[model samples]
Target: MTFPRVQPEPVYRNPEAVARAVGGKARGNRVTVHAPGHKKGSPEISILVDPSAPRGLLVNCFSGEDPVAMKDWVLAKCGEPEFTPGDRSERPEPRAHLKLVRRAEPPKPFNDQYLVARGYHRSATYDYTSTDGEVLFEVLRYEHPTDTKTFVQRQPDGHEGWLNGRGDAVPYRLHELAANTADPVFVVEGEKDADRLASLGYLATTVPNGSWPEDLSVLSGRTVYVLADNDATGDKKAVVAIDRLSGIATAYRIDLPGLPPKGDVSDWLDAGHSQDELEELCLSAVPIAANDNAPPGKPLSIFEWTVDRFVGEAPAVEYLVDGVIPLGIPGMVSAAGDTGKSFALLELHRRVAFGSGIYAPPIFGGRVVSEGVSVMITSEDDANEVHRRIAALDEKGDRFSSAGKRMIVVPLPSAGGARAFWKEDRRLGLIETDDFKRICDQLHSIEGLRLVTFDPLASFAHVALNEDPTAGQFVCSSLARLATETGATILTAHHMRKSKAPIETLADAREAIRGSTALVDGLRLAYAMWPADEARAKRTCKSLGIHYQPNRIVLGGVVKANGAARRIMSTYARNESGLLIDKTSGLGTSAPAQDDLRTALVIAIEAAANAGAPFTKTGASGLFEMRERLPEELRRIAKGRLDALAAEALERGEIVRSAAKGEKTAKWLDVPGGLFAIGLGNFTTGAPR
Candidate 1:
């Protein structure tokens, strides 16, 4: 008969260690050896041993007068069983692992000591418990002949396994999931707080067992917020964390109202406080104000966020001209490159600044938008070109510097370096954002500022026109924001994208944007200029020539006129040496001489022959007769002696001769499709050609 090999007992080294670990020892009345055909032993279970027997399963002895053994002590009674060679092929000595269920007192302080003295079991690394006091779960580890201590046990399918080091042993996968960001970070003093906070909604973490780690390396590039507890220890630990988080993330602290003398975040959470209360506590906490926060006075309480509701300083009420324009908003003038938008803005700006008689209807209208709307222009256009245009307009060949208080042109710094390059490089237009922001700062420094003109956004920006949306988005957004911040109208100049929609609305301005769509949506006032004929495919708005009046503010003018709503107008005008002049096509400055009226009568008489009813001359007499028919309510003027004509019209230009000698003069006659600026699908007037 053969018996299974039994490994030596040191426990971890062999099956003998398991016996010792489970409080087992050799029997007192013991047989020297056993074979397959041994006597049926009088033990509860007999171990018929062979030379190939599994480690401690042997029916050798029956113990006498041993200590009232534990209900689940390691019993050495084993019965023999047939072992198939196939089953034992790989495993040199195969055996079944089993344990009996029985109640036992948990390990206590003196339990291990009493067990060692009895010699029933040997002592291991940790002392055993003699009496129980909770935490009574028992875990067992397996061992091998080579003294290798294993932390796993045999699987049911007869495979081996180990304790889950990845699960219970450590937490390596944190903040790796999308849900992590959705969870608010909780700060605790120790692991206990972490466990407690986990019970709540927060994903809390704690410092190491010892002192807090010098730097919370996890916060290096994360968007984590600190919520330190409200105690000296917690606060001290929080300070350490705060120092480590310098410039890493935004952080805050939690203050528990009437907190326990030694409570932590868990204590507060355990007290049944809602998350809202905790949020309130967090928000009320102030930032770590530096000791030297000697700000002059509280920031002038301006809640600029509510754009329309804002009412500026004492001079808030602005008076305007003719009630046609309530108060010009000192708006922005924009157009495609070389279309004359810049020259127009410069001309109107110059006129408004000096209060010249030739008002171009932009920043004019007599609204003192902060000291006659101070023109703070960051000369984004060519200074020499601007000078030439100004000279040509003035008839004096004078440049801007000579304009004095009327024109405040901020020249580009003459530094000869990359700075100079940026001044001219349209790709560097992002500098305009910085420029706008800096202007805000300057406004704060100099008491107040009015209208700011950031010309030709491309000169300072590097965004792809029309292709990228951020350029437009940024310009428009910043324009609104800067306007709100300084309470000054921001007129940023930008080029129109080549491809535009049917008709450009302020909203569609997002698409026509040169660089970023953000600029279009962000801007409240989007002034798009095209060839006038094709700003949009539909020619919906006015398509007058991209006009200019060089007598206005240098680069500080706007183009919107009176009675402006969200309306598109097709303006018709003549270019007077690059200055925009209203055109009265074939209109007379005043009532003509009787012979001149007679000439018109003769033309109307002759023209009536081909038409339905023209000899009456009502078309030519209409506007003139309406003046005579005005009642006191309808006529603003109280019927004083009228100078037959508005004098200025007669001075500069001559009127075209009509068909007859005594013909009455007619000004511009508004006709059909007048909403569009007199130019649409018909790009040209064939008669003129």
Candidate 2:
């Protein structure tokens, strides 16, 4: 049978040919085509063709051709193709080959003239050399008359970058570091410092850039003194360096005083500091150790699962001011307006300063421990007011001889002066400010300081008392810490909330304290003071035979005593001289004595009325007869005292005087069915009109 003439498929020799055949751009350097008899797209029967044709034309070679003829053809046509032995098979395919060439790189740009135009003329160059003394990079410090100083670094490979970016950067003066490994090395922040230190005949080194180096292994086993710049960032970097070098080397951080912020060792030297002075400062630096970075040791386990562990191990409860004020415990004194809280605190301050018994019989029934120093930080009282109060306390004759020196009275400065206790800053909110630190330092310097009083807690606290509970707690906790650390009793005076209702009970009084409940919660002991009730004042007045002033009688009671059985109640009576007297003790004028005289006068008046010999005037025969008829209780009272009592009674209408004008003077008679008349035999049933 005669077959039609078969047409051969065109071969692709390059990307253009492949693009033409496939109608798409060639993607790669090689292409594959399948023969007609082979399964379409079968890799085994495919013709392997190179895009870079060696013969400069497409070759139509069959897969099963002679190997030597293919090689000779390739050699003759393409100058010689790289060949490798292939697997002998019934049907083999031509192998493909490829070669590659690299493109040239562009040159790096230099701007020496630009740097010069900017007034950057190199003043000094510091070589960052390797351990073998080969210069790996150079750090150039440029100076300008008008502009600030600038720095640039150049590498041996013509790579111009910042000093921090040098690829082969070692510590500046690495050779010197290697030679003086045993000597103390001064590690500064910059290359200039390192060079300046070296010029002073000292072994000095620094990192390539102003920043700390990542790999500090170069300083291993060496003694390094890192002189930190006087700024926050410098201090921070120095801390980091010290932390990194903790275990690897013996490192010390030297901080110089009187250096302005951002001032470095170079400035110190320029300020006329000598090498000897620098060495002395270095010697004062504290050494950095591995343990410095370690967290605090775990606290002792407080949870006791068994009684065996706690048997006989419980610590005794100590007191800072005995029973009333626990030692080293936080306490608060709160009072309503004009309640003599300040006078009470001043009295307490007096007792603490002189180590005398507080308020004679003791307000809270606690004895003073000793004559310890007392610190009174008052923000409400001015210097003159404080002085006046102190002078009044001195007049009481209860103050000790050493009270003047032992008592510290700090008056509240007007508006802008330093705060007595706590202060806040933008950087440090509340923990400790410069003023606070100064106060603390001053307090710590005092010997035997046992009592610390902050008058009006609100004035001393940086935070709003009622707005933030946490801040209140912080203030309380800080005071508590101070108390514990210094073994002092801390008492803070606070104000009570304004309310029309009276503080009847201890709980009511406690709730009346202004601000968050945290104030009471943080205290080991707390007391509240309020104006005495009208009935109480009346009773006191009647017994003491003194005119009653609501402000004169103040009642104080313990609101919280952490370990006490019940709240102790007490009274403070301010006399005409503005002296606060503890009424709990019979230290003031005897109320019982006055009560005896009132009773005597009542008996004499009732007896005279019953006998129809009522007193008719101030010095009448009836009044004289009544005095002679006085009872045994009234016998001891002086005639003048009895007359005064009778007059006072008549004025209050406890006794009535006859309005009849027949007598020369008004005749005084006892009120019928009155409190005093009821005790007498003449008891009238009707009320006196």
Candidate 3:
């Protein structure tokens, strides 16, 4: 039987040995080593040893060293040049390692004697358990012979004894925390502090090594208190915890009074602080409000400029739909009312959700590049309307079965009344709503999210988006942040300005989109759809041999691509099911193509009558004489086809012989409803003369 391939464990070197080889100093399991070829006073690079890391080491260069080079140098110093830099930014889901196979050998029974025999004394033990009370791992604290403190972890190997390496890291006493749903949870820095608080009959927990898990839904909708250490690192960790917990939980920062440098809750308790004092501090601490981050008191000084500051090759631009929609940025699609822009955006979202490989067929006539999960939030369409629209896209239900698995459709009216993501407050000016925060939290929790669409921008932006440029910019920037954080394309549908004239150019298309100029400027990509004007509609229908029905023919193109590619357009005819299908194929044909030839003859006959250069029916001065008057697209049609189409039009009464206005004897070949020739001399002779 075949089994899933397990990722091999990374080879790790002793932190002290690496520090010695690199002429650096070791602080616990981390080393601060200067960059190779470093000048005096240059900042040092930090190398951390982490067993759970894919590379077994994490490297950071605060000195602006190239990360790839710094990692290679550190690995070379540690005699493991094969190792590469690890991506430590992404925090995996908690308890993800539960499915992995355990070590073959069983863990030895752990006791104080085991450490005592090795000249070390056991100080404390913290059990990392699962929700079901299973002991996944244990973190053991030890006092070393060198008068220093250290911590090591061992995993339960299923049989009995512990394995050398640790299992999945989870919040301490997670089972207990999950059980007590009412009490406010105190989040401290270390396991010992959590234990201390737990001993006092209060619920508490801490994460392993200050690395916050990517998914923390258990603490969602609950009050959380972050008790940080009394040092710079602790302050940073507090900020991180607050940021990660944003939209997930209501968290507050607690700074204990009269604690020494680097001291923690354990030290505060050791100082004879009672539970009442901690509770008082917790109650008085202010909640971390949204957008509460304050700027630094002083501006940062200028740095030394260098020509070669950039270390690697420039990154290529990524796209969700090549040229039409860029990836990792916010963009917009807009059209007038009843123009089907929302339907177009929804269709795009569906196509992106079905996308999975390196390339896919262009769904909206643009290549699909990135594919994964897609989300669409509709403010105007409720559950039933959305269902009808989606159902119209596919009657067989085959595509929906596979695509629905990766697509999340939220109909706002049914879920709740539509809530604006950005709104103006009399006191606070412009601010993002709590709903926005919650939505962002949910988006972050979703793995493999590729696209997020907000149908009808005005629905989410409220009225301020139209009146205030600041609100427009703020809403767009906030959405951009969501896109960046989740690594997905954030697209929104907007309404175009109501106009009688058709949008004929890119500039016009830009102006046609409703809202302030800031809204258009803030987006990286913008596409627009519009109904064909009377003249263009008539032209298109005449060419394609179809009747012109208002709004049945639509034209759309990329109005703004932000330099990704040249502008492109596609002609679509709305089918009976209200779906837009590309009809550009009808325009492709030979020079003597029936559509072009007929259209040219009609145009030429009209132009001649208007210009007082009327053509006769059967002479050199006939319709072929007016070939140069045809539209540029049909000017290349062969002379013979032009004459044949003119003859056909005459025989079919598309064009008729009419008496000249001033000269009754002269006749001109004029379209049945076209403008008549004005003067006797401008008229054409009758029939086959």
Relative to the unseen true structure, what is the C-alpha lDDT of residue 330 in candidate 2, on a scale of 0 to 100?
Answer: 79
Query: What TM-score, over all chains together, does every model reach?
Result: 0.33, 0.49, 0.46
User: In model 1, where is the ten-residue run with the lowest total lDDT?
Assistant: 164-173
Ranking by lDDT: 3, 2, 1
Q: Candidate 2: list runs displaced more than 4 Å.
A: 1-295, 302-306, 309-316, 337-343, 357-366, 378-406, 409-416, 419-447, 532-551, 575-579, 586-689
Candidate 1 has an lDDT of 0.39
After the best TM-score superposition of candidate 1, give how far the Cα of residue 685 lies from its true spot, in angstroms. Answer: 48
Give the CA lDDT, 0 to 100, for residue 298 in model 3.
64
Which tens-of-lDDT digit does each residue in 1-689 have in candidate 1? 44565344421123333333433332221122222233333233223222333333333334332222311122322322333334443224434563335574332222232223333333122111112221112222333443433221111111332221111111112332123555446566655566565666656665432234443455444434455656666666775555455455455545577678767766776788877887777666544322122234566666756667746422322322221122324334555555566665565455445545433333321223233443545445455666676676666433334444545555343222111101223443433422333345555443334555656555545445455565556445545555565565566676765653432232343345455444454554455544433322122112323334322111111123222222222232325455533321222333333323322322222222222221111333332334343222212322222222212112312111122213344332211222111221111222110
Clashes of each: 76, 3, 5
Evaluated at residue 267, the lDDT of candidate 2 is: 94
Best by TM-score: 2
- Residue-level lDDT tens digits of model 3 in 343-386: 77777776777653444334444677787899999989899998
Candidate 2: worst-modelled 10 consecutive residues by lDDT: 39-48
Assess candidate 3 and give its lDDT.
Answer: 0.72
Summarize candidate 2's per-residue lDDT along 1-689 as a digit string, tens digits.
Answer: 43333333443455445434532222233233433334432222212344233333333445665545544444343344533445322113333443334463332332345457655687998888888997787787778888767666666654544322356446788888887767799888888788899998888887765545666667887778988999877876786666567667878778877677789999988988888999888887556534332345788876746657656433545655554577667789899987778777887778778666434655543566655788888887888888788787777554445457888888867435547355554554654333454466567678888788888887778776687777777787887777776788889898998878865556678888888888788777888888767877677666556788877777676777675212345566777657656565442343334543553465456445554455543544445444555555455556676677777867865466653223333354655442223332232344121
